[model samples]
Target chain A: MPMNEIWNRRLKKYQSMLLRYSKYILNDHFVLALLFFAGGLGLAYSNFVRNLPQKAFWWEQPILIIILFLLLHVGKLASLLEEADKIFLLPKDYQMKDYLKLALKHSTLVSCATQLICMLVLAPFILRGLQWSFGMWCTLLVVQCLLKLSCLTLVVTSAYDTNVKQFLQQFCFRLTLLIVLAVGLYLNLILSLLFSLILAVVTNYFFNKASQRHVFKWNDVVVYEKGRLMTLYRFINMFTDVPQIVGQTKRRKIFDFLLRSTSGNIYLFLYSRSFIRQSSFSGLFLRLLFLAGIIIFFSPNYLFSLLIACLFLYLIGIQLFGLYLTFEDNVFTHIYPIDESQQSFAFKKLLRKILLLAWIILNVIAVAKPLFKVEYLLIPVISLGEIYLITGIFLRNYIKKNT
Target chain B: MTLKINGLVGGYSRIPVLKDISFEVNSGQLVGLIGLNGAGKSTTINHIIGLLEPQKGNITIDDIKLKDNPKAYKGKLAYMPEMPVLYQELTLKEHLELTIMAYNLDPADTWKRANELLKTFRLDNKLDWFPANFSKGMRQKVMIVCAFMTKAQVYVIDEPFLGLDPLATRDLLNLVDTEKKRGAAILMSTHVLSTAQEYCDYFVLLHQGKIRAQGDLEELRSIFNDKQASLTDIYLGMTQDGHANE
Candidate 1:
């Protein structure tokens, strides 16, 4: 019942969940690969910057400043109130003000940290382009923190007013404030500080007015919290299994033809339909495949492109393994008289056909592009090997472990 | 056909929730599984459907043990869960089609029966509609249609009348009657004692994971020492007696 105890409990729960997934995300191989990628990009960026002319371009400072101002809008208030809290904590609703105060503090602090990091990242660009005084830079940081606080307040107040018209009105108001700050900063430091103070007062007024007018919309808060958690879970899902996230489905009738041809075996029909209709697995597959194709199309090295293609194929395979557990809780699946092994066979068959299609698409793209010519024939050959290895061996082990 | 459960003992974990439960559903018999919350009705059904392995017992459908030949045993029976468990992706027609394929039912005959069931349930116009769009009653109706279409030797339905409309409930009872006339065995669990007493040929009263009493209406009334007691009266009397014993 102590508000701080509840806050600490939620914080610890979320922290541990994030830590658990972060361990998987920060795996040695992945971290090293990321470092190499970042290092390569950094080198390219530094070379580009060094080769630049002495005078700063007219648009560079405005563009970077606008981007920094826009970044402040991305922060959300994490209330951490779950759907069940509506029923359980409804009696103690008045006491929730203290809880929400803590939530706001937590959200503001977290947003401030992100905003600081963004400023840090943009520091070199700002210094290179604007040539501002250190005191001015310090003033800019202060204005950004105040702007971020306003944005967070706006996000919280907006949750109370779920009407689309009111939401857009609030959004435009915030946008106007952002633009004012950006333009004021461009013109003079004193004007920007004055604009920030006005924005802070406006934000406080809006927050107070909204809180007084509306009792907390439990559904809106729960939905906002769920959406935030789902986004985190989705990101973590890429690195490791996160069972908390519920997948969505889409009726992709265009791909229904692929399933239509397969009949008689219910497992085949089920798996195929699930693969095409379930948005999470199919969406992940398509996104990864599209990314691979883009990367392959751009990369001048044919072998490296093929490697990227194979890597995506492996990712698709691993990701689709989640589909195996799709019907785990559906008792009808367990009640069905079909042989259990048939499910694995059907899943592998579906994967094989999908991977083959991806391989064909990638091969066609690779051949069509004139980036690298001689090793074009090798694309299919390598892809076929990777596909077989992934589907035949890796998938077999994955199914073994998951099942 | 007879669905026989003998000396069944099982629960979610090591602690047994159903203890030494025994029952049988013979051909043309509709056996109602009556129980309160936490009375092991679902666990008993789970064990019968092979979702939970009994700690010590055998469930045989028409002399075929589930462990001995799972496919054949499972094929012989159809199960409708308390809550409708449907695929979000599959449409009504596709659900029926998939059930047909899984049960290896004759396509033409089963499809005809499915169409009739769909029409009876007023879902004929929503063949292409997915379960996501179906209401609670409609979802339950879909499960009913799928199960009825299977035409298995035994049907194990749990709480079938929960969300059904009166018309759908009557239609379901009619369908069960038809199936019963065709010599299929049914073991249904329900809290609707009036409907159960009206339709069920026999009743198994479960209390605290054990069958406290089981018989037809007249027999149950006699057991409770009341010659003209309704099913509700018998049930209440049995439970109060259980409380007194406790």
Candidate 2:
């Protein structure tokens, strides 16, 4: 059994899974909402960029270096190793270097593409804000791609050498990356490009030597692979149910006081505790709220702010409808002595309160923007009305369809 | 004060798993529903707990059917499932709270009972932690505490001794004994023939969805015509004789 066949089969299956979930991710409504969000941000960004003084702000180069450096650390090594491989592939340990070489090559291709696209997006600011030459911008792109290659090498190196010091792999590697990126933006592009080239070469060479020196760290590698897979699954989970990812529970003891005030209604107690303690539910609510808050905070005009706020309210309400079925499989829910209709009513009450909180936060941001006017009072009035629609009709339809 | 299942035919799907099952667990009686794996013990229990609707016949508690009055029927029953079904986001204490809230028990009163049971199981100190993350035995203890704390008239417990330690198992049996004295009707299913032989007032030996033999220990031995046979031997004998007849 050649490992190449194994890698190809896994990559194919992995890709198809993503492709299947991508349809749900980019549904028309979500895409439209994302476009509106991006358009609003773009307007604000261009406005800010146009108004920039002829001289760069003192923090401009440092901020650019930080952004690009963080982007360099975006993608991880996708080993695709499963827990069963420890036993089944144990006899093939000698060939693991070849298998990992394939993994490294695949990761480099994906990550370099990511670096290239991000550099393209940041190209405008690099060109105008920093006033760099086209040649220097191209050099920075090359340096980003090279640095990303180095990042993958560092990750792969840790797989072969479990005893690799955290200081060496994590801190020093990141410190060197920051320094190189800072030098590239602040001092000279060619020198920084030269440094990253050497860094990438050294790390890849170290990977080969370590692979020869050490046995395959099967447990560590499998755990690393699972971590990477879970990260992907967690992201996709934001859009739809990913069975591979389980929602984790946190104690959240500080919110215990909130429970004291809640009545002893079965669904009310269950839903509130579920929302606050499960990372998936509360994380979704907060992530959407934060995104919408930022969008509305920079909303170019009153009408756009109103549009964005209402759109996000609807999105958050729909996403949270999943909470209703959280206890669907629990035997106690079916066996409990509570009235059946109370479940829906309690769910609606919680949903209304949550959306209304979003409404206040968003409307405050929209109205509190720099160009406030009395006429903008209509925004709050209309959004107050939007909350009722989302919590009432929108939620009703969502619940009806899902159930 | 009686739990009755008469001609109860049901399963997860249209095809019935429990066929013509009839039994009565009257007040103060501990009925051991003994069975092998896949012997429809759980299906029968699911029917009793109102999780599965009847395909043909009816299940009633004191002449009150689940379909006729679900709240009143369920309010009188407490179920401890084989696999612990816990709220992932709930703490150990919150599980008690949820139970009390769902059952409409006075929290002030149930909490006192819950603390004593929790102490008996050595789970009193785990109140603030999430029981969903507990060890298997610990989770089973949490389930026991919740079910017994409910103090309902009818207790339906399934395979409660699987993961419990000797001490916890003894504590559980003692709790069941006390509940029986207090007039709770318990219908427990288990493969632990030894314990069931001693504690259960009556036995309903289920084999392949049908009651093969049901009696007290002496009666079960007499049915097999072996006066000295243990419950395990009697059960194995009954199931084997069933296969021979088939």
Candidate whose TM-score is highest: 1
Model 1 chain B is weakest, by summed lDDT over 10 consecutive residues, at B127-136
In the range A110-200, model 1's lDDT, one tens digit per residue, is: 9888888888867766665566667777788778887788777776766564344876777687676667666655688778877877887
| Alpha-carbon local distance difference test for all models | 0.82, 0.87
Residue A295 Cα positional deviation in candidate 2, in Å, after optimal superposition: 1.8
Worst window of 10 by summed lDDT in candidate 2 chain A: A160-169
How does the DockQ of candidate 2 come out?
0.75
Candidate 1 clash pair list: none
- For candidate 1, lDDT tens digit of each residue in B133-231? 678999999999999999989999999998899999999999999999999999999999999989999999999989999888888888889998999
Assess candidate 1 and give its lDDT: 0.82
List TM-scores for all candidates, in order: 0.93, 0.92
DockQ of each: 0.78, 0.75
